[model samples]
Target: MTTYTPPQRTATLADAPAIAALMRASVLELFPRFYDERQTASAAKHIAAIDLLLIEDGTYFVHEADGEIVACGGWSKRNKTHAGDGDAADDDRPLDPATEPARVRAMFVRGDWTRRGLGRAILESCRLAAKAAGFTSLTLTATMPGVPLYRSFGFTEVERVMMTTPDGVDIPGAIMVKDIDRPDSIGP
Candidate 1:
């Protein structure tokens, strides 16, 4: 069994670039097996999709070994998908602190780090961070290769998300959600 060292704390701003590069490597190398080249290159690149998501909301986190980045993940207080309120202009309400949820925006680990449990560490870290930030549930859009990993973390299928890239390419993804802190139970 491979032993993985867990991170000490949440990621700092300096970790963003390395996190982005890892994301790029993951998408470029792993995504092509499941998604088209266009989707991999346009929508899944590190700087384009991940950098803004991380630097803006600052939900991104990273795990490093010997000063080298190994794993990363993030969650956001805002929902990136449209709420489908019938009116695209429906009164946009700020997220409710009690019931509103945050989302897992991106997650990745270096190729050499696979099977070392880095992914699980990152997922647990994201869940703990989101819970500490007062979020009850977490959501994320997963690519095909990520389905098993997300499922192992107790995420369930929600929907298929169709997204457009900066180059106007359509990227297909699976939507999954998980309640981090509470286990599913019947009402008493």
Candidate 2:
């Protein structure tokens, strides 16, 4: 018997709905273990949204199998570090690669696809793309369920943060960073 893996490609505007669905499902199914009910629900409502800027910037990606998007993620050269951050005014500002880290944003994998290297594969693609664009480092705000994956990819927690949802629920998360230009900072 053989297993077939779907190939990843850049996401388009047409993929937004599928990518959004995958992100919401990934959060709702995976976050309960690390967060309370309210936190999980709030995050699913806010953080799991699709950032159209990533798609327009050609930085978002999706892995489709049988015409269904099973996994999605992306890196951004823009100033928006994450969705639902409540700073939409400056979200589209381009980051200076020489002075700022590129952002690894909006990563998601279907619940059944956990531990299958999909997250790592997306991070590797992000790293290479950011490097090619002259960024020496990468940064992300990782929800609790995603901490281990980011750590395994050489990201270090810079600080703990609490994001307040529109409904005023506080969700705890971490800001992680990786100096991708370092020789020892290679992806897992």
Candidate 3:
């Protein structure tokens, strides 16, 4: 049997609603295994947000299957590491790729689409894109469910963190980093 892979493409502003829906579904279904009800709800509301700046920068991407977005993720050249932090003046500041690590932000895959290599494919794209933009490393803040995926993709845990949402719920997560310029790093 032939397995079909969805086509990936750069995300546009028009794709925002669909991507947001997908992120919520992914978090709602997968987060329960690692997070309690309150934490999950807080994450669904805050962490699943779309940063329009990524689309504007042409850095975000989505995987389309049957005319729907099944997966979405991207790398960012800006300072924001992840979404839902509320607005900050430095969030849009450009990172100097020569000295700073490019950020891998806002990765989400449909619940049913998990374990099918979509996350790896997205990470590979992020790594290549960041490298092409002159970044030597990449970093991401990974929610519990995403830790294994980032680990398998050559990212090492830098620190564990409790992400506090505006609602004051604490979500357990980790800061992960990968040296993209390393010869041993894996790719898709």
Candidate 4:
């Protein structure tokens, strides 16, 4: 069994380029399993860019090993659940923790680090942080290859969303949601 290490710290602006490169590598190498080349490339171009606001909000995290970032992901208390850097609009208003589910955004792993529990580690960090922020539930728009991982983490399919890239390419994804349990009800 692989032992996962906790993320080093919340992401910062300086980490954006590395995170973006990792996202591109992960997408190019993994997305092909579920998407055609055109679809994969289009989706990569649209999605690999990180939202700087997430890092600014201090919710984004990155795990490093051997002096390099191996995994990255985060949760958001904002209305905009998904978007790349250049794609984010002005409607990214904060969400009320009491009324809305926190969003799990921008999960990506280095291609060589796949299936090493790194993704799950970052996910647990997001869940715990979201729960502590008073969110009772979480939601994320999962790329096709990410469905199984989200399912393994107890998220259920809530809806299917088709995102049209700026170049007019439609990428399919699923909205997955999970309810967070109170500390008292969590099982060992």
> How far is 98's C-alpha from truth in model 1 (Å)?
1.7
lDDT (10s digit) by residue, model 4, range 78-105 = 8887756444564488888898999999
lDDT values, one for every candidate: 0.66, 0.88, 0.90, 0.83
Task: Kindly report which residue pairs in candidate 3 clash with one another.
Answer: none
lDDT, residue 33, candidate 1: 79
What is the TM-score of candidate 1? 0.79
Tell me the TM-score of each prediction against the true structure.
0.79, 0.93, 0.95, 0.90
Report the candidate with higher TM-score, 1 versus 2: 2
Best by lDDT: 3
Judging by lDDT, tell me the better candidate of 3 and 4.
3
Error of 4 at 29 (Å): 0.8
Backbone collision count in every prediction? Answer: 0, 0, 0, 0
Model 1: CA > 4 A from native: 6-8, 46-48, 52-58, 81-94, 183-188
Question: Residue by residue across 1-188, what tens digits does model 3's lDDT show?
Answer: 56677988999999999999999999999999999999999999999988989999999989999999999999999999886657668988999999999999999999889888788888888888999999999999999999989988889999999888888898989999999875335543
Candidate 3 C-alpha error for residue 106, in Å: 0.3
In angstroms, what RMSD does candidate 3 have relative to the true structure?
A: 1.6
Window of ten residues with lowest summed lDDT in model 2? 179-188
Q: Which TM-score value belongs to model 4? A: 0.90
In model 3, state the lDDT of residue 69.
Answer: 96
Task: Write the residue-wise lDDT of candidate 1 on 54-79 in tens digits.
Answer: 44565667778888787777776665
Off by over 4 Å in 4: 1-7, 85-90, 182-188
